[model samples]
Target: MAGSSFDNLPLEWIRAFEAAARMGSFTAAAVETGLTQSAISQRIGHLERRLGTRLFVRQARSIALTVEGDAWLPHVRTALESLRESSEALFGVARDRLTISASTSVIDLWITPRLDRLTQAIGGQITFRTMVLSTDAPHDDDTVRIRYGTGDWPQTYKQPLFSEVMAPVAAPALLHKDEAWQDLPRIAVSGPRPGWTEWCALTGTPTVPIPVLRFDTFASALAAARAGRGVLLASLPLCAADLSSGTLARIGDATLPHHATYWLIASKERLSRTQWGALSGALTLR
Candidate 1:
């Protein structure tokens, strides 16, 4: 069918078909769209009737896309995503709102408290939602993002927020209670690069091999350190509050270049509104 021909299809059927295609299961799509599985199947049936083709092939418990359906997925995804983006982009001009995706540590420790100040500086009542995303760029719903990485963020218009400094930190109790920090369990946070391996090189203590405790996020690792479990490699800006509030203390004067830096990124073609510009500025200022 031609591109314009899709407009002839019912909106409800199109929604069901796209959801089913993406999820590859009628039940999953139904759960997502708040429709019954039978309803989803009926809508897809309607869509298939309109197109005069099969969209899915039923397996034992799941559904698989037909060849045509497989080919159509990206196009449908792009079309729907673009429509949603445009709707949000043009949403209410005077009361524009922006949704941002970022890491949890950045949001909880940095942005949440400073959001009011950011709104005040931007001169609008712009609403925001900070979702934690796995990737560096904004996904299907979000238009703006703050990512932690090196200066070069993948395939997006990214502005440098700031580079992070890496150094060892521990709770005062942990350091005081244990004289064998070199042998005690050490907490590790995941990123491009982690641990005292590089930091030790900077401080000239490479042979120091402390037992490692791993956490997927810096917040958890910092929490472990604050709980007096062990020392953690702290990202300076991300742990400012902990350092300031005396919850954690530096293990030594050792420092090194962190592999990750905070970045404010957006899709170049997708971002054109004044609200986005104000949001971008607000992110860096805080």
Candidate 2:
């Protein structure tokens, strides 16, 4: 009897192969798939045998995908994605839980204040994952992400959360009435955003005082500014609440606009039209 082309091809074997290839380790794949290392290895072994080709070169400490495996990975991913999308479209249960991934500064300064409105708009339970680094990528389970970029992400529905306008800001206590705010100490935040150099260049100020305080995260710098530490180059949108409540005051009339800003993004396949609309509409700056 001749063997069928599709014989011995199982969903579990395919999943094991995909996970192991993507993660580059059977042990990691096992952790991701909630299986044991031996189970994952066995599944991949069975899959390789059924396909009559080696998918991985197993070394003592690591695994590398073979050329055939590398070539086939994208196709397998597409097929699995299609299956998942179709299944969700046809018979998926409506879930009220939503997960959002964003940097600590964004989560604290932007989302926290709008929680009530967001809850009302989405009508669901929301969970937030705080990203420590600006370069952190969203996990597969993160339904939505707030990222700082020029909004060029592929295969995702994205909208600018706000047009970032930067200006020097300081606590009222730090500035004496009728005194120039620029002469005070400067607080520097280290990141992609424009700093005192660009601000001074744009405003035609020859030079400003050197920064007395420096911090890596904007949130930390903002905290220092609020505590009367020094003048901070601040994103106006992020500090809107503070400005309104008099926690921080704009130093002058000058403002700097930048091309890159925070964007609200989500996978097109992960969100329905109504859900996407609700989420974006609720968050976008008016």
Candidate 3:
């Protein structure tokens, strides 16, 4: 705000108004910024009084930016991003901060091993959090969420990660190539997800395998498979490492085309340009 006509304006007022406008709700702004809803309201009123114009049109269940707010939004957003960049340049990123919400299978099999690369790509000290979400779990807006399904999550932005092909993988010890594949023991999981039934149809293999065990999570099933317990249908990409390391072996050359997709999502509120740029590039499909 230096060297400007509005240099005397309080920075907090601008920050509060920016949050309220971007979140489209005073309550949501308060939740995101750790301010009280009443405080957000008061700050908006204070800012409007100083500017001598209404910035928000309050409604029963929603809030919309007025013409004045709409005009000022982009400038404020750019200024905030600039301020953050300048502060980082001077402070050298005091602490790394990021949080991700994803499924256990993705975390254990896919993202966990690649965390070092992600950190290196971001180029800074970082504290990362991973929340294990179920396939049908709701989105937690406070962190970047990974979803498994069609690219439709309400009130958020979606970025495709990678769709996974289904395949049968098990420990090499469990495979008996001379024996009939359908007669082998099959491990399964309990969820609203596809499994050996779908895989059998895709590969033209018989669905007459006997079930020996049923786990509740893919991680557990994978562990059992690696221990030479039984064959399990798993996502091809997620288990690629195990396949490469000779821990898990595919039953045959048959592979099913990908259907379920993995998507990275963020809430509707705008983020710092630098932060998004760093993460979005770091997460780009390899």
TM-score of 1: 0.58
Q: Candidates' TM-scores?
A: 0.58, 0.66, 0.63
Best by lDDT: 2
Using alpha carbons, what is the TM-score of model 3? 0.63
lDDT by residue (1-286, candidate 1, tens digit) is 4766456778789899898887778998999889999999999998888788898998888889989998987888898878766876677344445566777777777777678767765564444565544553437666667766665654346776666788888888877773666666677766665567766666666445554678877777788888988878788777878898999988766677765777777774446545556666766663
Please report how far candidate 1 places residue 146 from its true position, in Å: 1.6
Name the 10 consecutive residues with the lowest summed lDDT in model 2.
Answer: 130-139
Report the C-alpha displacement of residue 259, candidate 3, in angstroms: 7.8
Greater TM-score among 1 and 3 belongs to 3
Candidate 1 clashing pairs? 149-261
Q: Per-residue lDDT for 1-286 in model 3, tens only? A: 6446455678888999999988889999999789999999999898888787899999998899999899999999999878876875675533255667676776777676777777875565544455544445564445567667667666345776666677788888778556765677899987645777877777777877657799887788889889988888877777788999999988777777665677777753433445555565666545
lDDT of each: 0.73, 0.86, 0.75
Best by TM-score: 2
Candidate ordering by lDDT (highest first): 2, 3, 1
Query: Total clashes, candidate 2?
Result: 0
